[model samples]
Target: MKSQIRVVWALMWSRAAVLRSDPERGEITTTVIVTALMAIAAIAIIGIIVAKLTQKANSIDLG
Candidate 1:
């Protein structure tokens, strides 16, 4: 089990090192910006959904 973990860790470290060494700006920058925009959109949508649900729940007549 320990050996398997070590092998996986080593592989991850090698890939990280490769990314760090290569400074390709275009793809990485575009990817980061798109990811951030998508995250913000998701949060806004979730907030709207929660607000709508709360409003509807409060309007219910549960006597």
Candidate 2:
């Protein structure tokens, strides 16, 4: 059982070191792009809502 465990662990590490780079690069690129896009979208949405609210506030006659 111990030898079997050692063999499996060695195989796992070898596989890990081999297919590590491309997947890591792809994951990082995807995360950065999604994060940037989400921030831009959030800012634009908030700006639009704020502008509409400002206009409405200015046109009110609350006397």
- Global lDDT scores for all candidate models: 0.94, 0.92
Tell me each candidate's RMSD, in Å, in order. 8.9, 3.7
Q: For candidate 2, give the lDDT.
A: 0.92
Estimate the TM-score of every prediction.
Answer: 0.61, 0.60
* lDDT (C-alpha) at residue 14 in model 1: 100
Each candidate's clash count: 0, 0
Residues 1-63 of candidate 1: C-alpha lDDT, one tens digit per residue:
999999999999999898888878468789999999999999999999999999999999999
